[model samples]
Structures are given as C-alpha cells and as structure tokens.
Target chain A: MSPPVAPLGWSRWLVPPAALSVHLSIGQAYAWSVFKPSLESALDLSGTQSALPFQLGIVMLGLSAAFGGTLVERNGPRWAMTVALICFSSGFLLSALGAATEQYWLIVFGYGFVGGIGLGIGYISPVSTLIKWFPDRPGMATGIAIMGFGGGALIASPWSAQMLESFGSDNTGIAQAFLVHGLTYAVFMSLGVLLVRVPRPAKTAADGGPAPLEGVQVSANSAIRTPQFWCLWVVLCMNVTAGIGILEKAAPMITDFFADTSTPVSASAAAGFVALLSAANMLGRIGWSSTSDLIGRKNIYRVYLGVGALMYALIAWVGDSSKPLFICCALVILSFYGGGFATIPAYLKDLFGTYQVGAIHGRLLTAWSTAGVLGPLIVNWIADRQEEAGKSGESLYGLSLIIMIGLLVIGFVANELVRPVHARHHIPAQKEAVDVHERQQPA
Target chain B: MSTSDSSPPDSSPSGRRGLITFAWLWVGAPLAYGLYELVRKATQLFTG
Candidate 1:
C-alpha cells in the first residue's frame, strides 16, 4: 500500500514529533538495568539469570529489525508503528503478569521476545518518514528523532526506580510498574500514529519535476552487494566497539581509576558520570549529526573515528591523574558514539537512496549488535583478567584503552575506504520505482 | 511514474506556525520532563 501522505494543510514540521513520540517510548529499552536488581531479589534469581531478559531483548532487536525491515517498507510507517506498539506494550503487560505470578520464564518470553520486536520495529519506523519530510537536511531530521532513543534511558531510569520504590520492590509492585509502563507507552505512541504524515509524491522528471534522489539511487538489495556497504558496516562496528569500551564500564572504570587519588570517587559520583555520559550521548546525536549537514558525512566519521582514537589514547595516558581531562574525553567520545548512530541514515541515503534506506538501515543494525557484544567483552574481560593479575586503579583499564584506540584506528581506515556506490550496483531506473519515488516526495 | 494528485491546499503563514508550535509542544513537553528528571538525578553526585 502507498504510505499515508500528509493531508492538505498538514505542516511537514509536525512529522518529527510523531517520530519522537515512538522513539522516546521505545528508548526505554536502555533503562532495563533499573529493574534488574528488583527482579533478582523478588524472583530469587542470580545476576546472570536476571540479565537474560535484557540481553535477549537486544539480540531480538537486531534479529527482528534485520528480518522485518522489508516488511516495514512494504507496509509503511503506520503499520510498522502499530506493530511496534502492540508488541512492545504487550511485552510489558505480559511481563507484568509474569512478575505478579513470579514466573521468571514468562517474564523472559514476554520482555525479550515480544518487547524486543517492538524495539526493532519502533526504532526504524520513523527513519524513512523523517528523511522524506526533511529531504533538504536528512541528517538533522533523523538526528532529532534518533536522539530520543539515546535519551530514553535518561527518562526511564528514574521513573522506573521511583515506581519500584513507591509500590514496593516486591513481585506485585514490579508487576504494577510494568503495567504502568505498558499503558503509558501505548497512549504516548498513539499520538505518533495519529500525527505522522508521509510527503505527497513528486511529479515525474518527464513532467519537469525533481526526482527523489539527487544522485545515484541503489536499492537495499543492490546496496548490500556493493563493497561500499560492507566498508560502512565495518566502519560502524568498529566505532561502536571503541565507544562501548568506555560506556559499558563508565561507573566502575571511573571509580577504579580514581581509587588511589587523594580524593577518591564515590559511588554517587560514579552515577553522576553515567548521567553525564547520557547527556553527551543525547546532545551529540542532535548536535554532531546536524554539524554533518555542513561538514559532510564522511568528514564527520573522520572526527568520530580518528579524533576519537586520539581521545582514547589521551584517556590512557592521563586519565587517572586529571579527573577533568578524563571527563572531557569520555563526554566527547560518547557524543561521537551518538553522532555515529544519527548520521548513518543520511549516509545510507547518500549511498543507497531513500527508497529502501529503512530496510538497509535495518540490515546495518546487525553491525551494532556485533559491536555491542565485541565492545563489552573486550573491556570487561580484559578488566577482569587485570583484576585477577593484581592490577588496581588506572592500571586496570590501561590495556583496554589501548585496545579501543586500535579498534578506532581500524574504523577510521574502514571509513576512509568508503566511496560512492558504483554504477554497476545502482538499481535500474524502472518506471515503477520512479513512480514510488515520486509519490514520496513533498509538493 | 506519473504525478496524479491535485495541487496542495494553500496554508496561511500563521496556520503553519501554529502547527509547528503544536508539534514542538507535543514532543518538547516530554523531553523537558525527561531533562528535569536527569538534572535531579545528576545532582546526587554533588550532594552525596
């Protein structure tokens, strides 16, 4: 079915809110840590057991997005959003029921399997719509919407904690919290469904009108075949892996680094560091990605990967001695991490075209999944080995930091290799594809 | 592909502004609340 174009008098500006509504709600995935302690205690589970839901949720998010991408493209944003709302909210409700009954398995099935699908679908749902609405500034448009996902945890962490506190951290209380989350998100996401509008299709080039793509347009299928896609894939994976080294260990690493200092870092201060990182992540999504509109996407990645490697090296060299320097490095790195995510859609649009950018983006998210695993494993495992070897303080992270620098350098190289999709890979300019394209452009 | 739709309805400048405002407030209110919560949590580092 043709996507729902904005009605007459509908301002294209309104579309971002619709995208944000869904994004902000699904971004709650990042806050699952808030419920971990409660689940472990109430369900009498081990740390690893309690973590199953969150880990599986992430795995499913990648899997579902990779698979559901084309289905989303075929059906349009409305259908995608509705599916996301149902699965995501229902995942919460089911988990609520599971919590009430103390069935850990049920909670896993509900949250990990069902809720994860919601996360994936909701994540990609707005991308194409936002790109269409802001064709002039695709990076800034997707940045605004994806930034919500970065900030989702900032909203959800405290909200979930307060709910657990007020309702009692027991089983029923957890259930109540889940219920509230499900219901509230359902209502909130409905607004996006109601408010979002696709652009009216453009007139054909034959009619002396602008085409949707200003340059070479590659279909998702053809785009995937090009070496350019794989190069970008490596670029994204390496960048995320390097950044996750710091993010996954922000609290513990900070405390460990400053333990021998005259003024030791406290637990509360470490928490603040995490909060600051979130702020950096959110701001970078909007700020750096918007900057990419001027600087060019390829140049922005150079900053993220190249300068980011330099920042990691600095952290390794002077991190423990200067708290201010450490904080600055971490914030800049996190911002680059967020910027990396926000810019990729526009990058894909540049290389692949808007026609299947969402689907292509979905496939690309698998790189994120890989980096998610690679980053944490490298950082945490090395840190663990260091601790076993009787290392302490800043020494604990020294090697891991070095490794991150190397990974970032690799990412920088991969980025430098990216070139425009070759003519051989461009989708043949069929009349139907052009028709679909014209229908999507704004008047 | 063919262009089949009629001309778009003309929107007054004020109407466009009002709609943009509506969209902003709709998304902005929640984001502002989120930021408020973050600031409150962040204060713990200094206070604690």
Candidate 2:
C-alpha cells in the first residue's frame, strides 16, 4: 500500500522556513565581493577577472532553475530540496578546497557551476508550494517566500565579512570560511528538508473554495504557447538586467561615481552603501509586490519600468552633484528590481492561472539567466573600456547607465503587450460541466 | 449551486489534527519570523 498522506492542515506555515533555508544559504552569493580584495591580493588577479566566479554563479543559477523546472514539478519539492542541499553545500566545500589549494578554476567550478545549481533549485522550491497553500492570497504567499531570498544577503553580508575578518582575510582564511559556510548551511538547510511536507489534494481543496481560480484558468502546457508568456519573459528580463547592473558592482560603482565629487565615499561608507542597497532590494520584494495586489499587476509594472527609467536618467544626467538624489534614485531603482522578482509569480497567475505556475515560472527564469550575463557585461565591460580610455570616477559608468535606460524602455513596451489570454485556450467548459454534473446528479 | 449543495462535510479533522499541530510548529513560526525580518529590514532602509 502507498504511504499515508498527511491530511493538509497548516502546511502553508512550513513554506517560509523552507524558503529561508535555501535563500539564506544562496544569499552568500552576494557576499562574494567581501572576498574579492583578498583574492586579488593573494592571486594577483584583475578586477574583472576576480568578478568571474560571482558572474558565472548567477549565470548558472538562471540556467539550472530554467532547465530543472519541469523535473521539479514531476519529482516533487522533497527531491528538488535535496538536490539543492547537496549541490549548494558541495559548492562551498569545493570552494574551500579550491581556496586552500590556490586553484582559481576550482573555485569557478565549485562555487559558480555547482553552487549556482543549488541557488536556482532552492530559490523555486518553496514558491509553488507556498502558492498552493495560500490560494486565497497568492501574491502575499509568494512575497513571503521571496522576501527570504532578498533578506538572505542581509544576514550573509555581515556574517561573511566577520568570518573573513576573523579568518585572516587571506587565502587560508578564505578557505576556512568556505568550510564553515558548507558545514553550517548543511545543518541549516537540513531543517527545511525535514520540515517540508506536501499538502494533500483534499486538504488543499478544503482550505479554500473554488474562489482560488478567480476568473481564469490555463494549463501549464497551453500557457507557454500564448503571447502573454513571451511578453512576461521580456518584462522580467528587462527588469532584472536594469537592477543587476548596479548590484553586481555595488561597491566599486558607488565609489567611482563619487570619487571626483566634494564628498568622496570612504571605505566604511561604501560598505554601508552596499548594505543599504541590499536592504532596499530585500524590502522591495515584500513591500512593492504586496502593494501590487492592491494596485493591480499592470499598474505596478508601469511604476517599475516607467519610474525605473526615470531614475536611471536622473543618475546619468545629474552625476554626483547631489548625494541625496543619487541615493534616492538608486533606492527606487533597486526597489523596482526587487519588485520585478516578487511580482512575476502573480503575473504568471494572472495570465496563465495557477495550474502549473511553478513549472511555467521555472521556464521563465531563463530570462533571468540571460539578463544575469547581459546586465553585468554591459556595465562592467563598458566601464572597463572607458577606464582604459582615461575616464575615471562617475564618467566611467555614464555609458552603462545609458544602456540600462534603453533596456528599461524596451521592458516598458513588453509590459504594455500583456493582456488576458483568449477563452479558446482555457479548459473546455463542457468537459468541466460534465464532471461537476455527474457528481451532482447521481448515476 | 445552492449554499447547502457542496461536497460532504469533512469527517477526518481528528485524523489530521496531529498534522494541523505539526504545521504550526514547522511552518507557522518560521514563516512569521521571515515576515518580521522583512519589515525590520525595510525600516532600516527607510530610516537609515
């Protein structure tokens, strides 16, 4: 006989811990910059060269999540969480080994290739589960899970910095830090795996009535065929690219922008700026996205794409003339960046229905992978070339900011393209009616 | 379509009572903490 399923009660509550376990562990990705100074000093690498691991890790995160989405749906959350635990923890172990041996390629392979897979899988594991549990509040449910992803960095940034400080900030220290990360995360993530339980179908139906379906229904297979899917893909790609351009180089970019101005960014102040941006990114995931439920999905994207472009323009034009302006524009831009991630699930729910939104969401993450590479490359590459041409400080990043503006404009157009799917694609009403009528009027 | 015409009433709430308890222990606290953290983080951003 098959094992007894736990009748669904409050499995919804379990979703957050599962989300935090994955997000907090993967959030270590953001803390990589703390180790950059040590790596450069010990390995004698250039800035761009040192950034390779982080860039590759992000690239892999998008790819693995996109490709593994369908498999996750079929095998269930337990399997996905297990794979994430193994890959993410092992990535850290391998990075520790690489650091100890002074092997850069190993670091790339372990942290970027292996760990990135963990990041992607872990990121999506709780999202669909949370949505299923809280059908009454899809946006709020998703926001709760995604908010962990944003805050993961807040906890990790300070913790990693403290570890590096204690461990000597040298190659040896870095390796030891990596070992601690591997061991501790393995323990932390295991709690989530143990606690996670899939809610039974009967229980899910009991928790909420048919009201969960709202006004639309679209199967996962049909969802991919619609123009709405492609429009959302464009929207996500543009939003991520705009935000990550600044995030990938938060420290250097801020310092560069203010170097020639009257108020030079001190080392501590630069670190504070990164912390502040991270805080904004985390907050926006919950705040702006929760607000989207009240304000409608389309209206919210208008703010993200429309206001986002204006923020970029202000930064590019004004330079560093006003510190308050610079901070305000960056905060708003980061908020939109974060809102893009938090809101996309609801956007999927809006257009495709919740049938297999997890799988559809998995497929959509390819846009994130594409933007992950494009955003950083456009900004860093342009800035590098400009620096070589004798540009310095704020002037170094001006061209990259212009490119971000162009991308946001395209995203705005894509958001405008979104509309409800045609009724022809919905599940056949006659078939649904027959199923219900058969149960109502006995054989 | 009448209010009294839906599916039969649940007879297994007792069987799943343990699970309801488990859900609170496992899921509720962590989910609540995560939200609290988000609010705390946001306040830091706006205020700082």
Off by over 4 Å in 2: A1-8, A39-52, A100-105, A169-172, A202-221, A384-398, A427-443, B1-48
Identify the leading candidate in terms of lDDT: 1
**Local accuracy of candidate 1 as per-residue lDDT tens digits, A50-120:** 98988888999999888898888877888788899999999999999999999999899999999999999
Q: Look at candidate 1 and give me any clashing residue pairs.
A: A201-A438, A201-A439, A202-A438
TM-scores, one per candidate:
0.94, 0.80
What is the C-alpha DockQ of each candidate?
Answer: 0.40, 0.12
Quote the lDDT for A165 in model 2.
89
Candidate 1 at residue A92, lDDT? 98
Worst 10-residue lDDT window for candidate 1 chain A reads A205-214
What's model 2's TM-score?
A: 0.80
Q: Which stretches of candidate 1 lie over 4 Å from their true place?
A: A205-213, A432-443, B1-13, B16-19, B46-48
